[model samples]
Target: MALSWDDEPTTAAPAAAAGNPEASAADVAKRVNADDKRIINAKTDVNQLVPFKYKWAWDKYLAGCANHWMPQEVNMQRDIELWKNPNGLTED
Candidate 1:
Protein backbone atom coordinates (compact mmCIF):
# COMPACT_ATOMS: atom_id res chain seq x y z
CA MET A 1 0.00 0.00 0.00
CA ALA A 2 1.24 3.48 -0.80
CA LEU A 3 2.16 5.77 2.12
CA SER A 4 0.20 8.63 0.60
CA TRP A 5 -2.44 10.45 2.72
CA ASP A 6 -5.16 9.75 0.11
CA ASP A 7 -4.60 5.96 0.40
CA GLU A 8 -4.88 5.79 4.20
CA PRO A 9 -8.21 5.49 5.95
CA THR A 10 -9.11 8.36 8.28
CA THR A 11 -9.79 7.77 11.97
CA ALA A 12 -11.04 10.34 14.43
CA ALA A 13 -9.09 11.04 17.62
CA PRO A 14 -10.33 9.12 20.67
CA ALA A 15 -12.57 10.94 23.11
CA ALA A 16 -10.86 12.42 26.19
CA ALA A 17 -10.64 10.02 29.10
CA ALA A 18 -12.76 10.90 32.10
CA GLY A 19 -10.30 9.71 34.76
CA ASN A 20 -6.55 9.69 35.22
CA PRO A 21 -4.77 8.15 32.27
CA GLU A 22 -2.36 6.35 34.56
CA ALA A 23 -3.80 3.33 36.36
CA SER A 24 -2.34 3.00 39.86
CA ALA A 25 -1.48 -0.41 41.31
CA ALA A 26 -4.31 0.03 43.78
CA ASP A 27 -6.71 0.72 40.95
CA VAL A 28 -5.85 -2.58 39.28
CA ALA A 29 -6.19 -4.44 42.58
CA LYS A 30 -9.62 -2.94 43.21
CA ARG A 31 -10.89 -3.91 39.77
CA VAL A 32 -9.57 -7.46 40.10
CA ASN A 33 -11.16 -7.89 43.51
CA ALA A 34 -14.30 -5.85 42.96
CA ASP A 35 -15.87 -8.42 40.61
CA ASP A 36 -15.10 -12.09 40.30
CA LYS A 37 -16.53 -12.23 36.77
CA ARG A 38 -13.68 -10.13 35.37
CA ILE A 39 -11.02 -12.57 36.54
CA ILE A 40 -13.21 -15.66 36.04
CA ASN A 41 -14.59 -15.23 32.53
CA ALA A 42 -14.67 -17.22 29.30
CA LYS A 43 -12.22 -14.68 27.80
CA THR A 44 -9.39 -15.48 30.22
CA ASP A 45 -5.97 -14.71 28.73
CA VAL A 46 -3.73 -17.74 28.03
CA ASN A 47 -6.77 -19.81 29.04
CA GLN A 48 -5.47 -19.61 32.63
CA LEU A 49 -8.54 -20.96 34.36
CA VAL A 50 -9.68 -19.24 37.54
CA PRO A 51 -8.37 -20.95 40.67
CA PHE A 52 -11.43 -19.82 42.58
CA LYS A 53 -13.99 -21.71 40.50
CA TYR A 54 -12.58 -25.26 40.51
CA LYS A 55 -9.78 -24.89 43.07
CA TRP A 56 -7.44 -27.90 42.67
CA ALA A 57 -8.79 -28.77 39.21
CA TRP A 58 -7.81 -25.32 37.97
CA ASP A 59 -4.30 -25.71 39.39
CA LYS A 60 -3.89 -29.12 37.71
CA TYR A 61 -5.12 -27.70 34.41
CA LEU A 62 -2.62 -24.80 34.55
CA ALA A 63 0.20 -27.21 35.36
CA GLY A 64 -0.75 -29.33 32.34
CA CYS A 65 -0.84 -26.27 30.07
CA ALA A 66 2.55 -25.05 31.33
CA ASN A 67 4.05 -28.32 30.18
CA HIS A 68 5.65 -28.26 26.68
CA TRP A 69 6.40 -31.78 25.52
CA MET A 70 5.66 -34.40 22.91
CA PRO A 71 4.17 -37.86 23.55
CA GLN A 72 7.10 -39.59 21.80
CA GLU A 73 9.50 -37.96 24.29
CA VAL A 74 7.85 -40.03 27.04
CA ASN A 75 8.31 -43.34 25.14
CA MET A 76 4.79 -44.74 24.61
CA GLN A 77 5.81 -47.11 21.84
CA ARG A 78 6.05 -50.08 24.23
CA ASP A 79 2.51 -49.47 25.41
CA ILE A 80 1.24 -49.43 21.83
CA GLU A 81 3.03 -52.71 21.06
CA LEU A 82 1.61 -54.32 24.17
CA TRP A 83 -1.90 -53.13 23.31
CA LYS A 84 -1.59 -54.83 19.92
CA ASN A 85 -0.93 -58.16 21.68
CA PRO A 86 -2.74 -58.19 25.03
CA ASN A 87 -2.36 -62.00 25.25
CA GLY A 88 1.44 -61.60 25.50
CA LEU A 89 1.19 -59.05 28.36
CA THR A 90 1.95 -59.96 31.97
CA GLU A 91 0.54 -58.62 35.27
CA ASP A 92 3.84 -56.83 35.91
Candidate 2:
Protein backbone atom coordinates (compact mmCIF):
# COMPACT_ATOMS: atom_id res chain seq x y z
CA MET A 1 0.00 0.00 0.00
CA ALA A 2 2.45 2.48 -1.12
CA LEU A 3 2.06 4.77 -4.19
CA SER A 4 4.85 5.71 -6.62
CA TRP A 5 5.34 8.85 -8.80
CA ASP A 6 4.12 7.09 -11.97
CA ASP A 7 1.06 5.60 -10.30
CA GLU A 8 -2.32 6.66 -11.75
CA PRO A 9 -5.01 7.99 -9.40
CA THR A 10 -7.91 5.62 -8.79
CA THR A 11 -10.24 8.55 -7.93
CA ALA A 12 -11.23 11.92 -9.32
CA ALA A 13 -10.40 15.32 -7.78
CA PRO A 14 -12.71 15.33 -4.76
CA ALA A 15 -13.18 19.03 -4.08
CA ALA A 16 -13.86 20.13 -7.69
CA ALA A 17 -16.34 17.38 -8.64
CA ALA A 18 -17.68 16.73 -5.17
CA GLY A 19 -21.44 17.31 -5.56
CA ASN A 20 -21.79 19.73 -8.49
CA PRO A 21 -21.46 17.38 -11.43
CA GLU A 22 -24.76 18.65 -12.87
CA ALA A 23 -23.63 22.30 -12.65
CA SER A 24 -20.30 21.46 -14.28
CA ALA A 25 -22.11 19.58 -17.07
CA ALA A 26 -24.46 22.52 -17.60
CA ASP A 27 -21.52 24.90 -17.91
CA VAL A 28 -19.88 22.62 -20.47
CA ALA A 29 -23.10 22.23 -22.51
CA LYS A 30 -23.61 25.98 -22.88
CA ARG A 31 -23.12 27.88 -26.19
CA VAL A 32 -19.83 27.69 -28.05
CA ASN A 33 -17.22 29.50 -25.94
CA ALA A 34 -15.07 32.32 -27.36
CA ASP A 35 -11.92 30.26 -26.82
CA ASP A 36 -13.34 27.54 -29.08
CA LYS A 37 -13.83 29.93 -32.03
CA ARG A 38 -11.55 29.90 -35.06
CA ILE A 39 -10.69 32.16 -38.00
CA ILE A 40 -11.90 29.55 -40.52
CA ASN A 41 -13.82 26.28 -40.59
CA ALA A 42 -15.16 26.74 -37.09
CA LYS A 43 -17.67 24.31 -35.61
CA THR A 44 -19.88 27.15 -34.34
CA ASP A 45 -22.19 29.34 -36.43
CA VAL A 46 -20.04 31.45 -38.79
CA ASN A 47 -22.84 33.91 -39.59
CA GLN A 48 -23.49 34.84 -35.96
CA LEU A 49 -22.49 38.51 -35.67
CA VAL A 50 -23.93 39.37 -32.25
CA PRO A 51 -21.81 37.04 -30.13
CA PHE A 52 -18.70 37.46 -32.29
CA LYS A 53 -15.46 36.19 -30.79
CA TYR A 54 -13.17 38.45 -32.86
CA LYS A 55 -14.85 41.82 -32.86
CA TRP A 56 -11.71 43.70 -33.85
CA ALA A 57 -11.15 41.45 -36.87
CA TRP A 58 -14.75 41.86 -37.99
CA ASP A 59 -14.49 45.65 -37.71
CA LYS A 60 -11.29 45.65 -39.73
CA TYR A 61 -12.94 43.55 -42.44
CA LEU A 62 -15.87 45.96 -42.59
CA ALA A 63 -13.53 48.95 -42.80
CA GLY A 64 -11.56 47.36 -45.64
CA CYS A 65 -14.76 46.63 -47.56
CA ALA A 66 -15.99 50.18 -47.08
CA ASN A 67 -12.72 51.73 -48.32
CA HIS A 68 -12.16 49.34 -51.22
CA TRP A 69 -12.02 50.62 -54.83
CA MET A 70 -14.76 49.20 -57.04
CA PRO A 71 -14.09 48.12 -60.62
CA GLN A 72 -16.97 50.30 -61.87
CA GLU A 73 -15.13 53.47 -60.85
CA VAL A 74 -12.43 52.88 -63.48
CA ASN A 75 -13.07 53.26 -67.26
CA MET A 76 -11.79 50.07 -68.89
CA GLN A 77 -12.61 50.99 -72.55
CA ARG A 78 -9.08 52.24 -73.36
CA ASP A 79 -7.51 49.28 -71.57
CA ILE A 80 -9.79 46.88 -73.40
CA GLU A 81 -8.89 48.43 -76.79
CA LEU A 82 -5.19 48.25 -75.95
CA TRP A 83 -5.58 44.68 -74.85
CA LYS A 84 -7.18 43.83 -78.19
CA ASN A 85 -4.18 45.49 -79.92
CA PRO A 86 -1.02 44.74 -77.92
CA ASN A 87 1.28 46.31 -80.59
CA GLY A 88 1.47 49.73 -78.84
CA LEU A 89 2.55 48.30 -75.50
CA THR A 90 6.06 47.11 -74.68
CA GLU A 91 6.73 43.41 -74.09
CA ASP A 92 7.86 44.09 -70.56
Over 5-90, each residue of candidate 2 has an lDDT whose tens digit, in order, gives: 57775763344364888877876686874534444434555556655469898888788778988889888999888888859577
Best by TM-score: 2
Give me the overall lDDT of model 1. 0.59
Give residue 76's lDDT in candidate 2 (0 to 100).
91
RMSD of 1: 19.4
Report the C-alpha displacement of residue 46, candidate 1, in angstroms: 19
Residue-level lDDT for 22 in candidate 1: 53
Q: Tens digits of per-residue lDDT for model 1 on 1-92?
A: 11444565768545445575454434545534332334433345443546557678878877887787878579887788888895968887
For model 2, what is the error of residue 13's alpha carbon versus the real structure, in angstroms, after optimal superposition? 34
